[model samples]
Target: MHQALLVPEVLLEIFAYLSIISYTQTTSTQKLLAALARTCKIFHEPAMYLLWTEIHGLEPLLGCVTRLHPLIYHSGTWWDDSDEPWTKGVEPLSAHEAHQFLRHSSRIRTLNIKSEHPHLLSVIPAEACVFPRLKSLSLSTTYLNLFLPHMLHRCHLLSVDEGLQSFVTRCIALEHLCIYTPHDVHGTANELISDRIHWCTRVVTLSCPILD
Candidate 1:
């Protein structure tokens, strides 16, 4: 049974199936994959590959670097009005930590950042934050302008705030774009969208509200 599982073709098929499940699941199961990696020498590389392939949030990815752990913190109020501390705010990773973070960033192909206050990203220097294998990015933050340029060269799918007028032009490789604009700020959002639509020649799928 061990020999059969060790066959090259069989191992590839097993890894592929695990990768699919990891990608489709809502909650990230990288920890489970990490555990599987320790079970045997042959499963190490493939298990680690699946664990790093698609990152749902920045915290787990940043957690890979031991030194950066102390810099991470939480800074938000509790929803239930309880005195419990919030563990969501993250301090900026230092230049050294940023470099360490970049080492793992290369393996990340998809990144989804949905937090209201994604302070963790601000710490990493824009130059060092480039993701070589990154193809998809979802950012819902007011600081879209800060990080958009660093990711533009490699990202093919993007979901960002509608107010980033100039940043939209640099998405030449984009095949899908999703813009989220608040109803109260529709005027500014519409103006920016209208001015920028001409620059998005590669966008095959565009999702945004009708601009008045």
Candidate 2:
């Protein structure tokens, strides 16, 4: 009798379970599994459901991942400041790559990157709207702009300088928009965002930004 051969698929499942334990929150581990699943199809269902169903990050409130699933997402602001010694020449995850990760998420209907790091932000390809289910967007610090023309149910304006003004001027069907900016900037751009709020209508709620 021949010995049974262990399938690579089974091994991948084992690896995924092991990798997930190291994650404290649900997001990173799920993301890792999603990445693994991309290597093959057998892992798709398990990986997508396990990881894509929900995502949590260090923030104050729920974010983009919430749009995909209505699960309780803890928002605690956490950052790793330790500088790992240079190994070979590996680079940090790129903005493009981060956005691509969402494409594979298969369940990310919302995206929240509203951290203080502006460089962590990047544009999502118009064609790469993997989350056709996407209905909401939240920025890390409102330092970015939205060029994608798709209609959103709710759009949270990141606390930015001039990006919000630039954004308000574009959204035509935007029903809900929250902006976090300086009082002066808001006062100045309020006219602009309000001007375009509707061809002839104004927004429902406007949160006044305080000067720091």
**TM-score (all chains, Cα) for each model:** 0.67, 0.44
Error of 2 at 145 (Å): 3.9
Predicted candidate 2: what Cα RMSD to the true structure?
11.2
Output the number of the lDDT-best candidate.
1
lDDT of 1 by residue, 159-211 (tens): 33454554554455767776665555556556666778757777677777655
Off by over 4 Å in 1: 1-12, 19-28, 67-91, 116-123, 127-129, 141-169
lDDT per prediction? 0.58, 0.46
Please state the error at residue 153 of candidate 2 in Å.
1.1
Question: What does candidate 1 score on TM?
Answer: 0.67
Worst 10 residues of 1 by lDDT: 76-85
Q: State residue 117's C-alpha deviation in candidate 1, in Å.
A: 5.5
Q: Which candidate comes out best when scored by TM-score?
A: 1
Shift in Å, residue 56, candidate 1? 1.6
Q: Model 2 — TM-score against the truth?
A: 0.44
